[model samples]
Target: MSHWKHVYEKWRSFEQLDPALKQELDKMADNEKELEDAFYTDLSFGTGGMRGELGPGTNRMNIYTVRKAVNGLADYLVAHVGDARDRGVAVAYDSRFKSQEFAIETAKVLGAYGIKAYVFDTLHPTPLLSFAVRYLKTAAGIMITASHNPPEYNGFKVYNDDGGQIVPDEAHQIIGCIQEVEDELTIPHLQKDELEAQDILNWIGKEIDRAYLDKLAEISKLATGEQQQDKDLQIVFTPLHGTAHDLVLRGLSQLNFHHVDVVEEQAAADPEFSTVKSPNPEEHQAFTMAIELGSQTNADVLIGTDPDADRLGVAAKDSSGHYTVLTGNQLGALMLDYILTHSVSNLPTKARMIKTIVTSELGRKIAADYGVETIDTLTGFKYIGEKIREFESTGETFMFGYEESYGYLIGDFTRDKDAVQAAVLACEMAYYWKRQGKTLFDALHSLYETYGYYLEDMSSLTLKGKEGAEKIAAIMETIRKEPLTEVGGLDVEYVEDYLAGERTVIGTKLKESIELPKENVVKYILGNDSWICLRPSGTEPKIKYYFGVCGSSAQEGQQRLADLKRDMEDVISRVHNV
Candidate 1:
């Protein structure tokens, strides 16, 4: 029999399988391809932790897989940290299907080892989970979510004692422990009642929520001596039917923003994300309902957040009274500008901004204009979070951190991308511009006029399952072996192979090593300072193309961006054919 067939029979023979998973397995018995995909390999547990479609497989986010992953975490903590049982993991979940169950499983797995678990009583945003780790003084944290993914997806993100996502070094250690497990299906876990009886299952909620909001409010005071008026600036918001609903509402109120309007249709805790095709705020289509509500209410700006509220999307009324959704890059620049301009008294000598390699250079330019240095890390919010901890220890001030995927952080209270804090700060920015008789759209155009028009965009191609994984690897290899000399009719000035940790000059052939940690990414810089980057998604079965170009005018910038995207898409298409 085939390898997958043997594994399938073995799984079917297990007696203690969950009833739902067992039924799913029995129903797909005749589907050979599905079975192979399910049993082909284990779900990846990288720096981002494990994420996949929810189903009954080692490669899925089922109870057994979650338990197995948690078993490794428990062991890693016990083997590495002293007094780990006393310093437990802070666990939180979003509104995704079975998120709560997975969170409970995580606690149970730890409890079986006599480790404490401080779990949130209800669904919460990912950032708050990070905050709870520090606020509750836990050893680590685990967030149950697949931020901005489709309804069928769920994930587990593990954070270290610093409350950021686990760095690669620690992730590898956990993986080593996970590989040592003899049988994931038979991993022993304490029952919920038993865990509570042992006093290792600690439930937390209102106190942490209040603490996060209070810290956010304390850090968001833009003008020191001002009482903060501008309540007339109308705003519309939608949480995209996820965990952010109640806390975001409370956060806005805490910030004293009274003219906020919400999209009731999408304001509830919904696991299916019924109103949209996908829950991601980065997509303009996800802002449709928010834009409608903003138009109806004649609001000055519209803000929408993904399920876990780690990523935020914004739309502002343009000159023609039409709401235009701003790109993540645009929002980042605006927020940086506002932070630097209004927080002069709060600025430290070493204040700086942090962004990923894939993010646009526009924000960097803006920070330069304000004299705040911009730092780049690999493309993950965890890296930015890690930097926050570094800045804390090094005495440098982390003014802001953001990614090009609608994730931003204004304060270091929460390590991950904080859409709730961003929402409040964005509202403050909108009002600041409103007070100047301008909109955020006006501010963006001003920024473009001052610092040449910078346009940014991203394209993602999803390739699923085992064959798709191999195809993605093949595509990456092909590109690395045979580099592109030019793109969009411009000469490739230099190529940065992050996997190889070197930047190669095209004409001189001189190579210099990159200082950042090595990652599987390649970036090509064009003659005109426009750049393109290609990398496989760490959390999803997708490859992404990031494009950025600067031009003397908006029309010219848009044209260049379009040409680059078209050329890159063609290249990807050619690879797909191969």
Candidate 2:
């Protein structure tokens, strides 16, 4: 018998299995392929915590699998964190299927281990969960969300004491702890009644919400009285049926932005994301309804947040009288400029903004213009959050942190990418320029005119199941063994192998250790801020090819991007064919 079949049989035979899950198991009893896919491996943590399609299998996300992960977390905290039981953990969830149930299970699992849990009573955004870990001073936090993944998926994100996603080092330790839980069926968890009786499963809200809102207020700059009178500059907002449905609007309202209109079709907490194919804010299709609303209202700007509200996307009226979506890098650069301009008095000497390595250089250049240094982490926002904790002790103030995936963090109140806080700041920034008789599009164009027109694009290839994983690994190995020396008639200046933590200068054997943590990433640098980076998606089953270039004008930038993309696609075909 196959190992996966054995695991499936064992789960099926368990008497205490969830009835719904048992039904699913029974339905797949004769479907060997489905059973194997479902049970081939246990759900594991990626850059985010355990995330997978919801199903009744060891590899899928279900009650048993979720319980196993939470049990491991509880055990890890107990053994490594002093007084962890008393400090406890905070739990929050999004509007995904089974998110609330998973949150409850997380609390019960902690309760079984005598660890207190402060579980939110209603669905909330991911950043709020990060903030709860700090505001509550919990040992750690658990957020039940798959972020911007499709409706069929769900995830478990764990945050350390600093309210940041656990870094690679911490994730490694937690993985080991999870491995120690040999049998998912044997994991123990307290019932809700039992948990309540022991005072281990406390419900929390209201106060944390108030505190987070208050913190947002401190960071949100009020529009000048003249800016306030620019009431004709309408704004369209949409949460895309996610957790920020009310708070983001309330946030804008608190700042006295009363002319805001909402995309009513997507204002509710909908798990299916019925209106959009995917709930991701980064994609243009996600803004279809918002764009319609914006056009109808003649709104000056449009904003959208991902399902968990950790990422925010923006679109504004361009000089062409059409709504153009701003890429994550463009928005980050604009916001950085606004923040610096407004914060000249309060700017620290060593203030800095952080971005992922794959993010465009425009923000870095903008930061430099303001005498602010920009630091690059690997791909994950966890690294940004980790740096925030480090900077706290180093006396370097963290001005902002953003990635090219539309995730932005302005205030340090939340360790993760915070769309709500970003929404507040972005609205203020848009309004500030509105008072100057300009739109965000105009402000963006001014930046490009000052700085060279920088452009970035990425392509992702989806691979599924165990075989797909093998191919992804092979693609990385092939690329690493034979690094590119030139791309699109441009010479590769350096090849940085992040997995080896080494950067090798082209034509020279000279090597320098990379200052960041080692990860399986390969990047090729070209002259003039043109480069290529290939990395596996941390949350999804995909490999990504990122290309960026800059030119004196938009047409030049567009041509360069097309040429680079064409070259990279050829490289991908060669690697995949092998």
Candidate 3:
């Protein structure tokens, strides 16, 4: 039998299921393609957690999968900790498809295991879940969200007691427990009201929100009277129909900014995200409404958060007075310079900035000028969160951290990337720049001057279906077997094979050791200050190639990047035959 057939039969054998889930699965049975896509493989519970389409299949995200993941977590908790039932877990969900239902399912699974569970009463952002984990002092946390993925997708992210995602060692333990649960149908759960009667389930709301906001308020430092006097700078914000609408606005309003406007049409909690093709704010098209409103109101800046409020995107009026969207790298560099210049003067000399290896290096230059250190982690923001935990354990201050995918975190209040905090900081920086009779564009130009111009771009090649997955694997295997010595008219100066934990320089006999966790990623550094990185998507059938180039001027940077991109594309196409 085919894999889909086996998976479908397993689910069909369940003696009882909620009527709604039964109906949904029955509806999918009529479409062979949909059934196959839904059941081709079980939704993976990997290093981060489980993510998949929300529907009725072994592979889809539903109550059953949620229960499975949570049950595994409960088992892990029982084995690793003493008095696990008293320690409890924190649960929060965003405004995505069936997010609330999944969160409830997770709670019931925990409750059935005689474990305590504290869940948010309503939809909350991902960062808040991270905050609640540390604030409530829970043993673990679960966030039911897909972050910035499309409306058709949903997910669950697991965090440890430190409010960061599970690292490789912990993830392996959880996966082992998940594998031990052979019968999903036999998994236990509790009724919502019954769990409430037991007093093991608690619903948390406003108090936590207030605490989170108060911490966000202290992210930027101002003089005694700055908040009251700097109130006229205009800005527009949109949540992209996610969970951060009110929270972000409240945070900004608390800063005493009077000229802020919310994109009312995009403020509603719509799981379908009808206002945009994709809720991801990283793309300029996601800000169409915000830009229109900004142009009309002459708003100094525009900000947006994706569905889960973990990622942020910004648009600023450039030298031409036209709205230009800032890439995640650009925003991180700007925010780093702004926060360090404003906040670090009062702090100790050992302050540090954290960024992913894939992030642009401009922030590093700025931090160096300020006499601060920058640390590079792997691709995921979870590693940055882990670093924050390390800092807390060792009494080192974590000033700021960001990734190149529109994710930023400040003040360590949240273990994940926080669009809510970034929105506040963006507005504050815009106000400061406005007071200087300059725009963020001007600020960026000054940054380019202080640090040389840096240009970076990434391209994703998405493959779907089982065949596509096989092809992607083949490509990676080929790259590992016959490494390229050159790309885009430049000699490969160094090749970093993360899979092997080795960095080798061409024509050199020495190989340096890397301390980071092993991942299947490869980086090729070229001689012209240009580099290309290749990695397979952890959750999807796709491979992403990132290219970076730096030059003496912005025009020179653009030209070099264009030429490099064209050459790389040619090389990749000829090699892959796609």
Candidate 4:
């Protein structure tokens, strides 16, 4: 009779459903709250594809939902491509629960449609999946991972032939195709053996790995002699029990980085991520193991990668002899300076850098000093990939791309953020500074001195479930309807409403259209060279606030950021009450 009840009834009527799934459904039969939460709506496939907790329901990540998503992709490839079977699709997974199973199931679904599926034989990082798409010349790609999410979560990320996540238009078409599939339970999948026998299924391994590693090696800016000399720099790395263990170690080894040590406890492929509360490298707690190892080895730098190994985090010893974690903005700025300064001779005539709008402006300033152009995209790395595609057409070379969330790309070989590449470059940067008797912290200080003190902070308020969804919508609507003219005693000189696709100058009341795609985000520019932006995270049930400020000194910058954060929270509290 109701939405949940209808879904429950439909799933109950499926005769061939897996017994485990049926058991899960039975457990929810009497729990109305849980049932509604699990079936009230389909798990959305956004621009990055569907991600949710693993369970049995339309609103969860399960075999049925995976089949449905893959079926939709299969149909789209068949309809849109000239030779879908020949182009095929590349599939990879990480070390999460059932990730390998999900990858196999996806291959099976595509195989049933007479579409070839190139799947990795073992758990691989997300960037390799992106590289596989281009190396194999696949029509599309799928990565079964949730990036840095907890062990309870898993997801499917779909990429186009260009190796970037599907943009809005293609995502819409795929969603349309998914909706057309009336019964997810009945989606056809061929047997793995049969698919292999018919040449519709293939397992990719060493060859792809070798090619990817070769391309990654090219990302190193240090000369062979320089890398050999820098090999004395002590380094510690941890994969956070995810997928980067092998490739990162091997990449560093290939570059002659001999004094590297891995946090042995966190080096294994652990689905539960037993070593940390969360697998996200962006969080300080995730670096606990690596930091300890760094101290023992007297390492110059420490690095950690999340579960899917697409994002990287770094910790370096300050002048006080204590390790301090660098925020994503800080790390991005350091990496940009390192790359541009070391590779000036090898850079193209028109080199460019790309960053998400939420990223700090300090990177732009550094790029300007190097005479390289900087471009801003929306929040997702997919948009950055799109810009790379545009650069290819215009004969502009992409030097680097990164997001505030710790994702980064150094070279064009991979269409996703690559911690492996970042780790290598980060090690080199640390070594370069260490050789000069300066720490990475010193490099950051020098940047501050040259570019003025820039401080940035981010906070997310997560609201879950149906009621929470409504509250999030209301918060965004209220902010859009009544914009803030001032925050923390700073005058708002301009307001950029991304949803409305316009930027308005408060003083002159002049408005200009924003050139980027429309998204539900609002940014306010302060007269003091500070800014604030509010946007709902596309992949999560949370509203994120980003604050940035520039001051005369580090202390001034930190204080201003604190004031802005407090004032912003007060503003949000009032808006929520309304």
Candidate 5:
């Protein structure tokens, strides 16, 4: 009599179910727990779209689920855009399992709804998908990728016409449309031949790629006249078996950087990402192959991009000849410093930079030093993209935007964080430092000395499945009920509860409204420029704790950051017990 059981029965009785899916259902007939887990509820689609393990159930990602999602998007488009077919939707997929299939399925669904679909001929990076939305002037866009998740996981991301992820309001509307569908198994989709004959599906490739790379080339600082001096700077680059291998190589080569070496083992388009435990560039283990290549080539710097090539990670050889992975915050600071310092003449008079609430304060300081204003948005690169759009309307220039999770954007040509541009900028930074007889590590030290020592660290705890989801909600509720007054032995100056849309001053308890859109996040400001933020991951089932502190010396900053992390962990443990 359970809802999931009833849904499972309906699916089992469906005559048109795919044979493979039917086989899976038969295999799970005797397994009650497995059935419950797979059919408990539909995979929740929000601003980030749906992500889950590949399987044959409502909670898993399959052809049925993909069709249902696209059906909802198609309906939403028809409702919003007057001529949906004319506006169309652009589609791109990465090198993930079933990515191409999902992309095609999405196109078929849209075509059945009389909406045109512009799809890439092959796998492309997420940023390029964003660019294609603007280039082709589509009503929306969809990207099929899990974006650095493990091989077992895949996802879909939806974007608005502005080339950014759908904002909260639009996401709610699309969710309503998705809920209206009574059965995922019965969602309509046109045959490929039918769509092609009707001209409802268009294939896009070389022209868009050329336009995007040309725009990226314009953002390069080293492409001007200093390429000759930087041509000898050794650089090791790896795409982590994603979509950046060819484009990044082509971009770097066009910039006249001849000493770049690619990690051959990881150059191929690999969905399994067999070389790394996880395709995430944020993890140190993901750089193993690139580090090995860096050592062999005596490269000055190493750069790696995630599976979708939107997030970038960098490692620089330190003084001791050991490769050290730079944190996302560190890399952002370095890129901001290099870009702002070198491009001062060309920067707009009212230029500004943006960072996420969970990102480090060091970027704000770096922006301040360069006389640029810094704005903070909720976590997620989409919010950054939204800010870029806002700036465009206001005639304000967007200098740079980044988050602590290795996502960076230099030019607004693409709304999302672009690893292609980041990789090239990082290489150029390394070469510039080389001309000064220094490594990026040395440059970072100099930055710390100039801007005071700032340290940041993030910790995430993954809680999976339905029970884990309930536990996560309970944890957030508990924290909201009993807000921390102080952390790490520092007095809490103020508390910003984004979910409640209020900032409460600790001593006076005077609350003010927060201007940003509502999200389930809480941040506690402490004395001595230390702070902590707690928020659930948007794309993953994990609660992340971001800790930051500023100190007069590197040793002091490291110790303070350690203390903050310990305190934050204790707080999480206490809340978990509740």
Candidate 6:
């Protein structure tokens, strides 16, 4: 029998399940299509951890699944240390359906395992939870957030003692424990009130928030009373109906940024994120309302954040006075440039910058211009976080880290991409530029002129269900067997096979070892500073292709990107046998 058949049979015989869950499972009986979609594969646990729709099926995310994961994590932690429970676990949730319930379930599972749980009293951003884990010296941390996914989607993100997501080796162990739990329903959990009574579960309140915000203030660039000349610069921002409503405005006010306009429609924390089709700031439609508000306020800059506020989107007034939504790469490069330029006094010569391998190479040039070194990690924020921990341990300075996905981090207080800190820095940079009688758009164009126009784009081809999984595997196999020697009429200069842990230069016999852990990813570097990478999403059922192009002019860069995208799509289609 297929995976779904087995899962359905097991679920049908399950006793003492919640009525809603039971009903959900019963509805799936004999519904091969839905059942297969839900149970064809296990929820993936990789570098970024797991994210999925919440339901009753084995593959779906639910209370029982949360408990299983937590129990597994508990086992892993206990094995790693004798007093694992004593170090405790910090838990937080964003404003989403069942987010609070899921967080509580995680805490209860830990509590049942005799582990202490420090649960946040209310919704908070993911970065704060990361910071809290390290600040409170917790053994681990958990954040219940779908992070810009639709309202129906939910997820569980696991963090290590260093406040970063569990790396591959640790993730493998956690996955093993999860698989060993033969009976999910039999997992132990403690009642909320009972857990508290035992003094092993503590409810954390505003004090933690205050402390986290205080640290944010330390890195803030607010000018002194008289030096706050840019206080009058008009700025508009929208949280897009997520958890950032109050925290962002509060941070801005604390930094003494006056004339800031918050979009009241998007201010309320709505789990559904009803105002926008998707919470992702990368989509131009996501910024429609914000753009309208920006025009009305004549704002110098506009900013938006995803549901958990871990990534930020930026829109700036261009020379034509029209607001343009900047791509993630553009925003990251602009932020990097601004930080390097303004923080020169505070920056040490040992400062280093980090970007994902797929991120624009313009950032590398900017770092070099500032006499700094730039390192490129894989295509995830966790890799960037790992680099941070590595550098900090070796006594190297971490100036900034960013990905092409609107995630950026400055200070090491948080080990993940921090929209909260990015927002603060964006506003401060806006102020600095405003004082110079220019907008961020002007600065971006200037950089582009000096460093050559760089363009990057991402596309994902999703395949769902059992057949979808098979198709994805076949695609990868075809790529391995018949690698493209050229794309868009450009010769492939280098190929990086992360799975093989080797980067090979074509024709010549040059090969270099990749220090990072191996993953199933393939990247091809073409001539003229153009490249493409293919990798399946660890948490979702999709294969994503990233394209990057650099040229002397914007039009040339765009044309090169378009051609590369077309060629890559052709390769994808052939792999899918479509």
Per-residue lDDT of candidate 6, residues 1-578 (tens digit): 87667877777777778788889877777777887777766766666568889888767888878888888899989998677789999999998989999999998899888999999898999998899999999999999998988888899999999999888878899888888888777798999898989998898889887887887877665546633343676778888887777777777777776777888888888987888899899888998988898989888889899889999999998878999988889988988888788777777868899998889899999999999999888888888888888886687889899999899998889999999889888888887788788888888888999999999999999997667777887888778778889998789999899899999999989999987678888999999999999888776778889999898998999899999999989889877875
| TM-score, structure 3 vs. true | 0.97
Q: Residue by residue across 283-321, what tens digits does model 2's lDDT show?
A: 899999999988888988899999899999999889889
Model 3 CA lDDT for position 414: 87
CA deviation > 4 Å runs, candidate 3: none
What is the TM-score (0 to 1) of candidate 6? 0.97
Instruction: Give the per-residue lDDT of model 1 (tens digit) for 1-578.
Output: 87767777878999988999999998988998898898878888987799999998888889998999999999999999988999899999999999999999999999999999999999999999999998888989999999888888899999999889998899999999998887889999999999999899999969999888888887665554443543677899999998777777787776668888899999998999999988888888888999888878899989998999899999998989999999899999999988888767657889889999999899999888778889999999989988888886798889899989989998888899999989888888898889899999999999999999999999988899998889889989989998999899888999999999999999895999998888999999997769999999998899988999999999999999999999999999999779
Q: Distance (Å) between predicted and true CA of 519, model 5?
A: 0.3
Candidate 4: tens digits of C-alpha lDDT, residues 1-578: 89788988888888888898899888878899988899999999997799999988899999999999999999999999989888899999999998999999999999999999999999999999999999999999999998888788899999999999998889999999998999888899998999989999999979998998899888888877765553778888899999999999888888888888889999999999998999988899988888888888898999999988899999999979989999999999999999999877777779999998889999999999988999999999999999999987899999999998999999888988889899988998898898899999999999999998998999888888887788899999999888888888899998999999999999786999999998999999996789999998877789999999998899999888998999999988888777
Candidate 4, pairs of clashing residues = none
- Kindly provide the TM-score of model 2 when superposed on the true structure, using C-alpha atoms: 0.98
Model 4 lDDT, full chain set: 0.91
Q: List the residue pairs that clash in candidate 1.
A: none
In model 5, the runs with Cα more than 4 Å from the true position are 227-230
Q: Return whichever of 5 and 6 wins on lDDT.
A: 5
| Candidates' RMSD to native | 1.2, 1.3, 1.5, 1.1, 1.2, 1.7
Clashes of 3: 0
- lDDT score at residue 2, model 2, on the 0-100 scale: 87
Model 2 sits at a Cα RMSD from the real structure of 1.3
lDDT for residue 87 in candidate 6, whole number 0-100: 90
lDDT of each: 0.90, 0.90, 0.87, 0.91, 0.91, 0.86
Which digits, one per residue and each the tens of the lDDT, describe model 3 over residues 339-410? 888876586567889998888889889989888889989899889999988986677778889988899998
- lDDT measured at residue 281 in model 2 versus the true structure, 0 to 100: 84
Q: Which 10-residue span in candidate 4 carries the lowest summed lDDT?
A: 223-232
lDDT comparison, 1 vs 4, better candidate: 4
